[model samples]
Target: MIDLITAGLDWPVVVALLLTSCAASFITAAFGIGGGGVMLAVLASLLPPLAIIPVHGVVQLGSNAGRSVLFLRYMRWELFWPFAIGSVIGVAVGGMTVVQLDPGWLQIAVGAFILWTVFGKTPGIFKRSGPVAGAFSSFLTMFIGGTGPFVAAYVKAQDLERHSHVATQAVLMTLQHGLKSLMFGFLGFAFSEWAGFIAALIVAGFVGTWLGKHMLARINEKRFKLALNAILTVLSLRLIWSGVRLVFGI
Candidate 1:
């Protein structure tokens, strides 16, 4: 019944979340970096504060995993193990210090850096620092719950081709979200009650990702890069504003 699938939330809310999952996946699959933030914004409005990051992590794990599987062939194998190792270490550190530091200034710094990478001269360091990027973004995502843009900014700096860019980002995010989910489980979040709703969200995301792959194939690289940069610019600005608000206690 709708109640079971909604996990005691209203059916309309569940329906809205399902739709968001699909739409957010479509955007990320087609464009490469906006969907997780979109999904997080929507979930923040609908879910309780305590449930947001953990639930978002599970849903993102599913979304990115689907994209990773679909674009497996295009993944940059060289970066995987280093990023994975860094992510493991980062998550371990985040688990221990999740609540110690304030993330406000950190968000501002990340957003500004992303803007610089997109517009100004990108540091050569980014192209060689897969583990560092993975570790920093993974540690930050534990607090902000929306580090796809942070990771994407790094991926973009690599100057990868469109397919490789998307594929590699998907795989990296799958690892990050997977680790975050396990950490949340270790922290005692009850995922059982949300399983049915999360399943519905994942199924919707998969469907959207499948459809979006076709769109991605149609976009020329030049236009894809343009659109991606535009999206990143907007997202970075939003992040900056949020950090400003947090820091100023506005």
Candidate 2:
């Protein structure tokens, strides 16, 4: 992996990757959903398939950790335990069964679900049921890579304050990604093989998150939601397309 990255075949590609990491991290810090999904899509296209999920997990772990630290005080502690428990159960099932599933079909389903939400016709399912929402969303996250928007949609419907919203999402994401990283490790994903690149991406995410913290303070909550929804819609389309290509071998 390092050899491919360092072959000097094209410095522009490296620059683009770094830029994508920064943009995605900043979006994640500010909005809580775009970073991981965007980064995963771009990196999946560039890197080996074996490296995609683990590498994305590590980078997102750093990004969410930074967000959690910056907004620690605003986190809703009451929500953590149930959500964490559900996430653990969900990720375990997802990790164990994910390989048996067709990636293309999974992507299409996820993409369709996201689009349904973006269209504003989906009725609120989690607003009145916190535990159920936490458990199911966390489970879907294990297979989907990033489910922040679903969680955010629930929180929004409940009218959570901006700080609590960001903070709560950060906490949930941190738990999910941490568990994912551990699972990947046990499965022999070879973190050491991409240590240098992963380390660089983490540092880049850290810097992006730091900058995002400042911007988050100044941005209006409504505007942030609008931007997040827009980007997520775009990401959903891209993921769907990628899945189609993979499945059809076109």
> For candidate 2, lDDT tens digit of each residue in 1-250?
6554433325665667788888888887777567877788788788776777777887788778888998899998887887777777777777786456676877777677777767666566555666666666655655556566666655555566677877888887788778888888887888876676666677778788888878888878888777767877887787689679879997
Candidate 1 off by > 4 Å: none
Q: Could you say which candidate leads in lDDT?
A: 1
- Model 2 scores worst on lDDT over the 10 consecutive residues at 1-10
lDDT string, candidate 1, 1-250, tens digits: 6655898888789989999999999999999989999999999999999899999999999999999999999999998888898899888899899366776888798899889989998888776888888898889888888999988988898888999999999999999999999999998999998998998999999999998899999999999999999999999998898899999998
Q: Each prediction's TM-score against the native?
A: 0.97, 0.83
Provide the global lDDT of candidate 1 against the true structure. Answer: 0.92
| Local distance difference test scores for all models | 0.92, 0.73
